[model samples]
Target: MAEIKVEKKKPIWPWIIAGLIVLVILYFLFANGDDDEMIDETEQEQVIDTTSIEEENTANWDNNRNDTVGGVDGYLSYIGDESRMGIDHEYTNNAIIYLMNAVQAKANELNVNIDADIEEIRQKAEKITQDPMATNHADKIKDAGSDLTNVIENLQEEQFPDLSQDVQEVKSAVQDIDGSVLTLEQKDKVNKFFDEAGDVLNKMS
Candidate 1:
């Protein structure tokens, strides 16, 4: 017998099956990693930023605080809100001083001298300013306000033709504001100053 060489063919099906199994395992691992990354991203997106909310709240508070004070104009401070008038002595004193100055200015404008009349009023204002929670603060303001209003009203009509009408209106304004509310500020204490005389002073040209 001649030498015979026999060749055995190896089946490739086992290798193919092994390759398919590896591919399936890799797919599952990668798919799980991608899902985990997506979950982390979703968690980050769901987080809320409170910094902007806090800033907005602070801004609103500042606005409310600013609204409480109308502001100081020249020699006058708005004296806070009307609700704090009677109890707020410092502001009340400031308002009285404003009225006193207004009266003197008006007299000067009309070429009249009221230095003597205003001296007493000035003293009262000084007292209110120095005293803490003065028991008679309201009374002092009322007296001073009335005195100044009368002085302004008594301007000689012959010399000041507007005394009977315009000045009279000013007097009425003062009387009306005595125990009432004024703009953004003033009340039982500084009502005459803000509601009455302050308005007039603002209108004075």
Candidate 2:
């Protein structure tokens, strides 16, 4: 028998060790992948939470319009467009109507009676602007704004006689004026009225 030079079987241990190394590398890769996915999910949740907080803050700001005189001032100020030409007859007329409406609403809230009729004032303002002979429609609107200021002042004095009533009524009236429009002068008057009224209300509280 030829001396069986049985080739020593290639060490099986080396092949087994290589296989084990490959499995270890694969395990580390899979673990790292899972960790990356978890990190991504956590970051996404944080972003969502931040967005929700921002939305809530915005909502709170809007809701403030219904609580205080300053809020009404903010609402009205936002609506008035200074860029709109006061010389435009139609625009002036519409501005007067809006002013009258805002005044009337505030008066009603305070349980004060305004002698002027809002609808009548609106109609008259419109007619004055439309008349070809009218040369001073803008001045007329300014006069209306003045009249509104007078009414607000009168209310601030007389309507707020009772602290409970004044506080309650003012609270009820504190709401968003979504579509209010005014001229620059009218806006100033409105802001002044609110300032005075707020002082009175604060005293009562």
Candidate 3:
């Protein structure tokens, strides 16, 4: 009898399973990469939208004009109905700018430099200049208000007392300045500052 040898076949299941696992891993890697790309694109779009909004605001500010100014109010004092005093309120918090503008305009008309007085007022109103809508600095607000009254009085008395008889009215108006919005009384007081001041401005014009 001749010796016979039988050869056994190797199992292919393990190799097939390994190949399927490799395919799954490749698929997941590509899918995650695609997801990251999409996220990046979305972020870029958001940034573009934000940039456009800021640009539109800048354009509006440059093109906007106010024409309803009456009496002593400067036509350029406010863009639209609000008294912006040519200030970009979005970037600035100068609460007393309106008052400052009133005085500056008068000083300019008289060919005088009241920079010292203005700086003194600014120093007294550090809280207001830093944040217009602040309400916490009671003493600071009071002191600044007092300084405003005194400044207006001195400016009027030294320059032309006949121009305005109600220079003291600013004290009441300044007391109500807890925020940017003004009450009727506040507006009237401010108008007093600008009323006769406007006459001087008109003469210069």
Candidate 4:
């Protein structure tokens, strides 16, 4: 009888178990990788949003600063309109009063300190406006002219070089108004000041 050699069959379970272990490990690694990617994406988005907010805040601040700086130009236009309207009619006193008010308001806005004499002159102009037929109307106008001159003189040329010249012209025109009437020449002179001041302010930026 020939002895039959029985071949030993290797168990397949070990191979199957090793393959399953590999699959589990792969699954866990892939899952952790996805989580890491999600975290990175979220962090990136947060950074982008934070940067946008910072940029928006900076733009808003610049806009506000520009508006404040440009306020004088708008006020000057308003004064010009009032002056033209008043000069064309019998409300010269009222025009002067409104003009001085504009000046005072602008001074306050710019944090400029008005001299006491200018304030007194402004008050007198206001009173004259309340009574157009006041006997001291001419005197009040002259005093306001003086005040304007003083204001122009006190202003630092280095700080307001562009404005000083126009303001000086305005003072000259105001001084030329000898009576309650606004002459056409004086009106033209005042308008010239407006034109020059507007040009200067527009060129600021």
Off by over 4 Å in 3: 1-95, 129-135, 172-205
Candidate 2: give the clashing pairs: none
Q: Roughly what TM-score does model 4 have, to 2 decimal places?
A: 0.42
The global Cα lDDT (0 to 1) of model 2 is: 0.49
Q: Give RMSD to native, each candidate.
A: 14.6, 13.9, 8.8, 17.0
In model 4, pairs of residues that clash are none
lDDT of 1 by residue, 60-102 (tens): 3333321313222433445335455545465566565555655
> Once all C-alphas are superposed, what RMSD does model 2 give against the true structure?
13.9
TM-score of each: 0.47, 0.37, 0.45, 0.42
List of clashing residue pairs for candidate 1:
none
Model 4, stretches more than 4 Å misplaced? 1-77, 80-94, 115-118, 134-136, 156-158, 162-164, 180-205
lDDT of 2 by residue, 1-205 (tens): 6776667777789899999999999999999999999999999999999998867645543433223343334335533553453444444443444445555556666666663544444444555445534555435544444444455546656655555444443333322111133333344443343333444433432
**Residue 23 CA error for candidate 1 (Å)?**
79
Per-residue lDDT tens digits for candidate 3, residues 1-205, read 9989988899999999999999999999999999999999999999999999878754532322211113225422431233533222231223344445555556666677767776776665544333444434444544555675666666676776664545444555455444434222244443443333333434333
Ranking by TM-score: 1, 3, 4, 2
- Assess the local accuracy of residue 35 in candidate 3 as a C-alpha lDDT between 0 and 100: 95
How far residue 189's Cα lies from its native spot in candidate 2, in Å, is 11
Ranking by lDDT: 1, 4, 3, 2
lDDT of 4 by residue, 23-101 (tens): 9999999999999999999999999999997686455333332133335454455555634435223344434443444
Predicted structure 1: clash tally:
0
* Model 2 CA deviation exceeding 4 Å by range: 1-79, 115-120, 160-205
Which whole-number lDDT from 0 to 100 does residue 32 have in model 1? 100
TM-score of candidate 3 versus the correct structure, residues matched by position: 0.45
